[model samples]
Target: MTKLQSGMSRRYFLQVTGSGLVTATALGGSALQARAEPYDTFTWISPRGTLEVLDDYPYWSALKMGYFGDLKTEMQPGPSDGTATVKFVDVGQADMGFPSPGVFSFAIENGMNLKSVFHMGARDTFSIAFRKGEGTRDLKQLEGKTILLGSAAWQSIVDPMLAAQGVDITKVNYVEAGWPTWATALAAGQGDAALSWEGLRAEWIANGLEFEYWLGVQHSTLPANTFVVRSADLEDPDRKAFLEKYLRGWAMGLEFGYLNPRAAVEAVYEQFPTFASNTGPELGTTSILQQINVFRGDMENREGWGWHDMSSWQAFFDQIHAIGQITKPVKAEDVCTNELIAAANDFDHEKVKADAEAYQLSEEFAAIDVENIQAHMFDNAV
Candidate 1:
């Protein structure tokens, strides 16, 4: 198979398993009639700043498409830090928020009652990018070399990737770095390597940097970015409705994005016009379509579009516990619930698959080439 074809096959296999599809009842009249109460409005918090693409894009699409019209959602923006977002949810300032699974693992270790409802990206898109001539084919080569990282959570990710390759992190020199300053720090020769996401990889490559990636190894332990809610909120009927409706709308929005790349690109650009100037229209458009394709292509045919697997969850928690990231063993039951995702199963799965496949073959998918594919797939923008 050609590289593109191989990529498509990989995409299909990942979606089939990653999307978490389980055979279940549809949200037919019987399911809807079973609800005993009326829906109420709820507030969701997303990270603030222009980088809202990861957290706010789906919500924005849902709102634009009237996905949450029935539940009446009010979105509030919070700081980008996942830990801060968790605090906002804990204090009841927000009913729901976006946090990386690493943050969730940290909170659960500390005995926080957090639960993740949706999986934002199918795979870990963050990586450690190194200069090409550095002889750094693997993490082991970094032994005794200084590496830059943004947060402790990043260590959780890097630790395992290195461990698997038989490299001990204790042997490496670690530097605490700020997210915004990481790219420049590496380019200026201040750090041997930088922990980065796909977007940063694209930016670096565009600027003439030669680098190889160490894609987010977090998925080997935990889900990447997930929509999390406090455990107390799961029983609320409105909260349930909000999640169900939101997922449905999100699935649709993803499909819409896949089917209409130019339109989706315009929508994303409209929301974050600064990208046009910084990355230019061509690269910006490429970045957005890559994300849309990866998300839709990998998740379209799965049983749960954004639900976590029980085995995967348990394995992740086990790893987190071993690393001292959590004080106690975290259970799958404690961190995530399938109630809402199970409810979404009532919608048409075959139709969802068909739409997603059509999207994979659309012009938007075709517009992306392999080298740029990795970059766009993880673009932080919508």
Candidate 2:
């Protein structure tokens, strides 16, 4: 993958630590305190600047439902740098990190000894959004059009997705319109389209930047995001057990969202009132339901949530490498595993579903017509 010119890099990570840009005390000093001792708090870092986004409904749901009973947890919103989440986990600053498959692969290529423990997004969540009535029914029509991106680093993400659809990526132009504003730029006619994903689609509408979309969840065959941790931790029994427990909480949380998307949105809203006030209950629920669809793709054929389809992952790796996004070859088994999947799924399904059905909602959340929202969830999807 191409390194970000203004973002984090392997050399930058090493140089920063070596030059004291990051204080030793803040980075666990010399002992890496986060991993050296068995701690009560399990920290999961986000790949973005804030955790207020609706994409993390599962974690917020788990937090609200007390699914992680007695297991102290912390949700740390890392920097907006694309590589910060994996870097934090690599240096023991955080216990786990949620990274896109592209970012995870980049970390591995840079020699970070990390393993994806839980495959959270079973399907690709990336998408391309065009001004309403301006998108083509076929991706090939985008060959000569420009696509807006939050950062140049995202080109690596868009390349393979376009290639998968047989689009001539060489003919496509990408413009880095900057983060937190790419959607607005698209609305202002700054570009022909902007990169987007499941949860963000609803949030964009709430922001009044509605656009027609070619959703990756419906088009791309690549693997999506996953939860990764230090590989060595998996060998230790205590850490391994804790990892399973953490993943189980998320799995149950996903189940909860599937059963009651409104309740899931209510949980997220309780955790992030500012975000709730901005998007309202209807759009918040819409976002949660959108991700629910990605998180649990082809449920009938899958063993459970967090199950990795190694074949599909392998194909994704092959496609990226073929497109020259990855310089070195990557094997699916080396980057991810399904060992924790069975243990993570060993939970009381009936109880989780019951909890979802019984979850109390705020007046606004209670008034949301989730069925109607779901029924038109893909209205803008091309």
Candidate 3:
């Protein structure tokens, strides 16, 4: 057998060997199928706008390659509103939803019954942006200055970081500026600084807006993006199997993207035709890949792809609980299971490693211009 097939066989052997005792005890006379039947359709929701970049081009590649066919996913892209996504999943309007980790954690703590299954991007994508060559070298300089912020959760991350540098948030005037108004507000001198993600920073810098990034001061340990399914759905054997298969496909997609970024970009362009006109397909794809790489940089070598360990989850949960974002603490079991991810790791270690290496070597890893599609769309609408 080939190395890949041999690996698969080994994993199957392990699964069969490990579960043999449990199967004998759990089912004395009943027959258990070796493989579950695939679902007909699985609907998924994602935030609207450029944030859809989280969906990643390799996902499209995987879909085109029939990676998710085993689960029979229909793959629907929904609006970007977190509240709406949560509501849809809770009411059965949607089978799954992707929301920022902060939003999902808050929802779960409040008894939303939303269980996070997979972490899409693994790092804190948010950052503070200031004009280059300004006195905004560190978090300390922001004291007594007006800063534009989105909302409470946004400030939660910033406040702690600032306080660590002897700067109290109360000392700084925090204006309520939505994300749509951030770039303009900062450029128009409405605030001394703005809180944004690296994608936004990339767009602003590309547009000739030079800014200094405070990489040292991060506000939250929460996973920036994640996939969640309703509690009821988890009880269904077919649905559960589908979820496992979907995650396997997703890991494959991510691995493919890491392996061949250019091909993945082409795949995304073909799937999302609108991407062609939005910001130049090449640029958009490059931007998406770059952001993924940035997040992977933290735990690339050790953790493997899309692997969220118990310790990392607990650390992030504790941060949320401490900030009042989550009313009650959630145990790691409440969120995700590493069993399937571990299975994926075992299924194709060499492919995973090769993909990781390719991502580390890609040219897009250096830099890519991100367009402020939010701003551009608003401008065109007006």
RMSD of each: 13.4, 5.2, 13.3
Ten-residue segment with the worst summed lDDT in candidate 2?
Answer: 24-33
Which residue pairs in candidate 2 collide?
none
Candidate 3 residue pairs in backbone clash: 47-80, 48-80
User: Cα lDDT for residue 59, model 2?
Assistant: 82
lDDT of 3 by residue, 1-382 (tens): 0011121111112112453321111122222122222334566765432323434564676786666665556554443233445545544445677666666665575456677777665766666676555534457678788777655335544654455455755777777776456667877777888766644554554445656666431443545666777665567776666677777777777777666555566566666566444545445554555555544546644455566656667766776566566678878777765545654443464754565454442354234333443233212110
Candidate 1 accuracy as TM-score: 0.73
Q: Supply the TM-score for candidate 3.
A: 0.69
| lDDT pick, better of 2 and 3 | 2
> Which consecutive 10 residues in model 3 have the weakest lDDT in total?
1-10
Residue by residue across 70-115, what tens digits does model 1's lDDT show? 6666766554343555555554445676666666675565445678
Better of 2 and 3 by TM-score: 2
For candidate 2, what is the TM-score?
A: 0.90
Ranking by TM-score: 2, 1, 3
lDDT per residue for candidate 2 within 1-382, as digits (tens), equals 1111233323223334553443212222222313345646788988766799977888888878888888888888866666777877776767798888778877776677889988888889999999989976688998998999887767777888889899999999999887788899999989898889899999998988889999898777788889999887888888888889988999999999899888888777778878889999888888888899999998897889999989889998898889877888899998889999999999999999889878777787788898898899889987
**Backbone clash tally (model 3):** 2
